[model samples]
Target: MTTNSTEKRAVRTSVLRASFLYADGATRLTDKYHTSPIKIAKSFPLKDQLAVIVMDASPGLLEGDCYELDWQAREFSHAYITNQSYMKVHPSSTSEEAMGSSISQTFRLGDNAIIEHMPEPVMLYKDAKLHSTTSVHLGPGSVWMQAEVICPGRTLRNEQFQYAELRSSLSVYYGDELIFAQRQRVVPGQHQLAAPGCWGEMTHMASFCLFTDQLTSSQIGLIKQLVDDLPATGDHQVVVGISETERYGLVAVAASTAAWPLQEAMRYLWNHARNIVLRKESVYFMYS
Candidate 1:
């Protein structure tokens, strides 16, 4: 299939603008813009940065739907953002172009700023098609934590890897230098993702990026040990790997049949990294 086929889908674009600023020794939501099917709310308080949740008015994305999100974190500001629940991508016919839903997000960070963007898992129904893209640009001394999770299909309905297509891309950069990038395209009909040497029966996958300029050698070693000790294989376990990135950063990738293992692994790593940087336990981000 040509790229034009994917581009020809009817576009339903929704834009969200959000920014954080440092004020009165605390970070707050300085500016925000949203519309239907995309809502933002910040009621809980964190230790230093503001915490917010992105909400979807509709249950899930329909055919030919495209969503976009734009966020900026100014200098000396901090923020952590998450969603209310899992993202559901409904199925569509394979005979038509743009037979799926697409989501795009872009982040801009200033020097000495921090942002943690961790959304929930995405559940792809049987015969479902989805395309997702995320890009982050960071200034010197900035940090951004991002993660994405993908579920094969509705396991409760005995639907696994029945989707027609799934494509995704994530990229992080600092001053025009790409620090980390990941792209994947899965067509279960042509690829044996469940076969040996592949996902090997795993029904879920997750990827995370932790970009910061404040990690010591000792802390990095400790995190490496934790990643190495993660569960490798089981009914509800995940196999995880951690690697170093430019600018004192780390990236963790995991795959499993269940989502909890990956979620817990990410939580531990994120908290560990934050504790080392801030010199305090990251209880607020975990609880609130």
Candidate 2:
């Protein structure tokens, strides 16, 4: 089936804005707005925090599609945000139209606020190109944690690393000071992604970052031990490393042949960090 031109361009750009506030002794989704193809599926209350799932109505991101998401948490509020499914990037129609899709996300937190932003893995199709940027601003005593997984084009189809390009940039600011910044650009045809000091033999990669003043050296050690304890067999080999940031918090990177192992490692470290920062247990969500 062919897509109609009008329908394809109907929602070239979509926006989602959500705000959480601590009220009535619990965190609540006080305000929210969304455009077509992007909406909040639902929000669930877990312990002292609120969990919200963002869902995309369209099949996947198409060429020229752009998504903007903004989230805010009020003082003492704790929120967890996740996507319902993989962020699928479709192939460009032609080499000349390889700019492809983009996603921009911004997060702001008030004093003592906490946010756990964990989304599903990204699946890039052959010839697909995607650019994603994330900016976070934290207030005093606030914490922000994010986890991301990137999968080399559909591996079963033998299209691994066939994408035109993938660029991701992230910046975190504590007050007016930039605590962490990272920029990654990968062009499969131009870069030796599988060579030493690069991705090596790993087909998937995951990154986790926690920004907060509550980070401790002992906590980093425990996180490293957690990553080391993950089972690494021939079928599902994974290599993960953790390090402290320039100022506060820590960053962990993992490379694996499959996404599941990386995801598992991310979850383990996320739980540990949450406990250290918020003194809370892991909150599970049912992904569709």
Candidate 3:
């Protein structure tokens, strides 16, 4: 009946020390959220930043849990961000705070800067409700690749997030203006996953994206092949699609999480993209 109650509310925020100039150069530095969630720092030697990572301070989130993160990149910086794993939202009970929640983030990249973000999936517990939003900005000659996964409750445990409502949105901006945005809202009780043309058939769900500079002919071929492998069935599909924005970059999005054959197919697609960039014969990092 109230936004705050006797239930103990726990929170932490911190920005880790951003390292720089060292030869070994810091690849990553965890700010330790439970210890501190806000007042963070920028990892130095950031001339070409690589990834901005945010994580829950605890092992997992419980009812009434709230997390927030924000990041920025200077001109010509580059960074790639990847989450640790699937984020689970533990259910709440009548005994105490039968509620769990989280918030969105704003990410910025300056001129000639780049950022690659891939956060683990956020799970919605049975009878849970929450909202999420993300905004990203990039400059010229910049690149980024990201992926997200969402599971239907914990399938291995025979759990279902029934009677839950979740909404998530992600937007990208460039040249001081809005460029791309997508949002997803799922309310199982009021809405239906199997009503007509919605989910109707699948259980687990996921979404993956690759945003970066122009790809070679070889790269294009690999992407096309992966799309062709999507399950012929409309309901059992991976929702594979490609887009070219900003006149100099391309993005690949694939969503799927079927049992085996489909799961393996998704893995193959991920490997294909990673291989292309890591295996470049004479590739170079511009900021260096």
Identify the candidate with maximal TM-score.
Answer: 2
Per-residue CA lDDT of candidate 3, range 1-288, in tens? 666566655542223323111124433433223234322332333333444344445556555656665655555555555444456666655343445466656665555444555555666667666667777766664554555556667656665547266788977766666667778888776677776767655666655555544446677567666667654644555665665555334455544544333344445555566567434222122111
Position 22, candidate 3: lDDT: 12
Badly placed stretches (over 4 Å) of model 2 are 1-11, 231-234, 286-288
| lDDT ranking from best candidate downward | 2, 1, 3
Quality of model 2 by C-alpha lDDT: 0.86
lDDT of candidate 1 over 1-288, digit per residue (tens): 546544556767676889989889988887889877887955355877788898888878777778899999999888888988889999876775645788899999999898888788898998888999989998988888877778888888988899888999888888788877779899999998878989987788887787766667787788777776664445676778888876657888888887766776677767776776655576534413
lDDT of each model, Cα atoms only? 0.80, 0.86, 0.53
In model 3, which regions exceed 4 Å deviation? 1-55, 92-99, 161-163, 212-222, 229-271, 274-288
Instruction: Give the clashing residue pairs of candidate 1, or none.
Output: none
**Residue 134 miss distance in model 3 (angstroms):** 1.0
Can you write out model 2's per-residue Cα lDDT over 73-185, one digit (the tens) per residue?
Answer: 99999998998989999997554534689999999999989999999999999988899999999998998999889998888899899988899999999999998899999
Q: What range of 10 consecutive residues in model 1 has the weakest lDDT sum?
A: 279-288
TM-score of candidate 1 relative to the true fold: 0.90
Flag regions of model 1 displaced more than 4 Å.
1-9, 229-235, 246-248, 284-288
Better of 1 and 3 by lDDT: 1
Better of 2 and 3 by lDDT: 2
TM-score of 3: 0.67
